[model samples]
Target: MDAAGLALVLATLRLSTPLGVAAMGELVGQRAGVLNIGIEGLMLVGAFGAFAVGVATGSVLLATGAAVGLGCLLAAIFAWFVLNQRADPIVTGTAVNLLALGGTGSAYRLLFPPERPIVSPPAVPDLVPGVGVFLLVAVLLVVAVAILLSRTRIGLEIRATGERAEAAHNEGIPVMRLRWACTLFGGACAGLAGAILVLWISQSFVEGMTAGRGFIALSLVLFGGYRPARIVAGALLFGGANALQFQLQAAGFEIPYALLLMTPYVLTLIVLALYAGRAHAPGDLARPFVART
Candidate 1:
């Protein structure tokens, strides 16, 4: 590829990293029959945590850990509601999104007011001078998740749980325990994704910085038909759409800025409209499991 083409490719990969990571986690949860729309909330909290910790300690490692920790905490709360209380996953997730939005905004204002915005928080160290460490991590996660879903006994049980939780439970699989584990895993992944966004991509935090990427990650799961390879491809497509607007503006294209900003979301809608119905979701997804006496 030429220089411009290479730059676009790199930017696409960088942009896709967060989505890919989050989507992989979501896939795992869905495979275990859990649906977490709270991924957006998890990511938002994670970004804020990473930013806050990074600013306080000036340590990227600490910030990343804080992000994951926060994500797990939030996900645990979510699991209690949906998994234990049998709340509606969609409604609970919407609540999570709202909570994160309001909570993060309030925290940001209280901690760093308009008079003093956050500046130069610690950044994730790169593996190579120009390439980010998380990018490699994202790629490895893809391979790992693919193998995890296809190769292991745990993978079979997870698939069985999603396909038929009752059957899996009857077969002696710990249905509730497995679901709990998957939900927490999803939360950790969402947090890591948030860390990548702040430490590697933005190097700063803003309220609602996730900007619907969580929802987009959900779509990516469906778009990829719940498969890892296809999900990575979808992430690349969305990432390319995101990068295209910047490239066009840089190249002095005459397109309106607002329209450029809409490219990724518009593509998301188009893809969903085209393929959502064709994709098969887990049979028991989003259904709260209640043990029968």
Candidate 2:
């Protein structure tokens, strides 16, 4: 590949890392019949946690840990509301998104006032100068998740839960417990994704740095038809659009900047419109499960 081609390829891989990771987690949760719309909020919280902890301690490991910790914490709360209280997943997810958005924005402004400029923290060390360690980790995670959902007995139970919670329950599967675990795992993946975005890609955190990637990840899961390999392909497709826009702007294309910036989202909408109805979601998706005596 030529220099531009190589650059585009690298950027595509780098950009897709987080989306692929997060989408895989979402796939797992959805397979287990929990649709977590709060993924955006989880990512936002994780990004802030990583930024704050990284700046305070200057340790990449600790910052990443903080990000995962915060993501899991928020996910746990969300699980309690939806899983335990039987709250609507959509409502709870929306609240989580709002909470993360306002909470992070407020915390950021308070911690670093407008007067003082924020500095980027030390990034996760790269495996090779240009290629990030997280890229490799993401690949491994995708493979692991694929195996987890396809080859394991637990995977069967998860699928069973999504298909029919009552039936799965009768079959001796701990439906609620499995959903809770999957939800937490999804949160952890989202947190790690946020860390990758800040520490690996942007190397800094901005208010709402995640933008709508969380939503994009959700779309990706649907676009991929809940399959791991297809999901990664979907992530790459969107990521390539993102990289293309950046390349166009850098090469001084005449396209309007606003138009260029919206490329990925526009593609997302188009893809969804084309495939949304065709894709078959889990039968029990977004439906709250109540155990029967």
Candidate 3:
């Protein structure tokens, strides 16, 4: 392959890693009966947190830790509203998105005062050669998560909470606790995904940087039937489409840049149309789980 082709292939892997991680995380959350539409907001917080911490401390590891924490914080807040208070998941999720949008924008202003230069953080160090390592890691994470959700005791409780909270509650499964834990864990993963993308790959956390990646990941969860490996495939497919768009641009195709930007969304719509409803969601996705007296 030519240099550009090689670059495109490498870039594809890097771009897909974050989505894969985020999707896997969401798969876990949704499996446990929590629907977090605020992944976009959580991701943005993680991205910005990584950038800010990385720049201040000059430590990528610290940055990643901060990213995970921030993601969990956002997730915890969402859990409070949806799981505990019985708020509408979609409405609360949208609020999370708005919070992230404004918070990041405000953070930038504070970080870069009028006289200071706008500085991006140093790049995140790669664990192995090239971006392929992240892709490989994404694969491993999917497998690990699938095993956790399907094989372990804690996993069983998690599934129990989602599939039937009242029965699980009577069975002493601590349904609310399980939901909160899974939601927090999932959010942390989402945050780490965004952090890796911004600090290691994109090297910048510009406003609205996550764009619709969180939404895409959410859709992948539905399309993949909440299976970890299948979710990875869906993410890779979306990532592959994104990669191809750049390739088409480099190939001197006469398509408008705007059209290239639309490719991912178009694919999302297509996938939703063909694959949605085919995938089975947990028995109680948006239902308020209440313990029977």
Candidate 4:
């Protein structure tokens, strides 16, 4: 590839890093029967948390930790309501997204008054040939999650819970606990994505900086048929679309700016329309598990 082409490829990888990680995380949760729609909120909270802590401590490490920790914490709350209280996952998840949006905006305004300027944190250094450390971490995580879900005993239990919760329970699996763990793990991945955005991609939080990427990741799970390798492919495709948009705009293409901006999402919708219903999903997806007497 030429220099310009190589640059675009690198940019695509960077853009896809967050989406890839988040999608894999959500894939794991869905495999365990936890449809976490609050992923957006968890990511928003993590971004703000990471930005706030990074600014205070001037430590990228602390910022990343805060993001992941906050993500898992929010996931725990979601798990409590959905798993223990039997709350509606859709309703609770939507509420969480709204809360994160409003809460993060308000907190940012309060902490950094109109008179003060927003400070950007240092970007995480590139650890690989062309990508940052977070991107490397995301790739490793994708590989690890893929292996865990496909090659391990816990993986079997998780898949079983999603496929047939009552059956898994009857066979002596802890359905509730497995769901909780998967949800929390998903939250951690979402949080890591947030940290990557704030600390590496954007270097700052702007309330809803996630820009619906969490939802896109959710769609990617479906687009990939809930498979790890396919999820990576979907993420890269989306990332390529984004990069193409940027390149087209940079090249002064005649397309309208709005149309260019909508490229990735438009592609996503088309793909989902084609494959969503046809693809095989877990039988027990989105259904809460209730034990029998």
> Can you write out model 2's per-residue Cα lDDT over 42-153, one digit (the tens) per residue?
9989889988898889988898899889999999999999999989999999999999999999999999887987677678777876788888889999999999999999
lDDT of each: 0.91, 0.91, 0.84, 0.90
lDDT of 3 at 167: 80
Task: State in Å the error of residue 88, model 3.
Answer: 0.7
Task: Encode model 3's per-residue lDDT on 1-293: one tens digit a residue.
Answer: 98887777777777778988998888888878888999989898999899989888887778888999999998899999999899999999999999988998899778866698767776765666675345656777888898899899988888888888788888999888888888898888889887877776887778889989999999989888888878878887888788888888888999988888988888899999998969878888777787777
- Model 3's alpha-carbon lDDT is 0.84
Model 1 compared with the native: what TM-score?
A: 0.97
Error of 3 at 173 (Å): 1.0
| Backbone steric clashes in candidate 3, count | 0
Q: What are the models' TM-scores?
A: 0.97, 0.98, 0.95, 0.97
Q: TM-score: which is higher, 1 or 4?
A: 1
Better of 2 and 3 by lDDT: 2
For TM-score, candidate 3 versus 4, the one ahead is: 4
Per-residue error for 137 in candidate 1, Å, reads 1.3
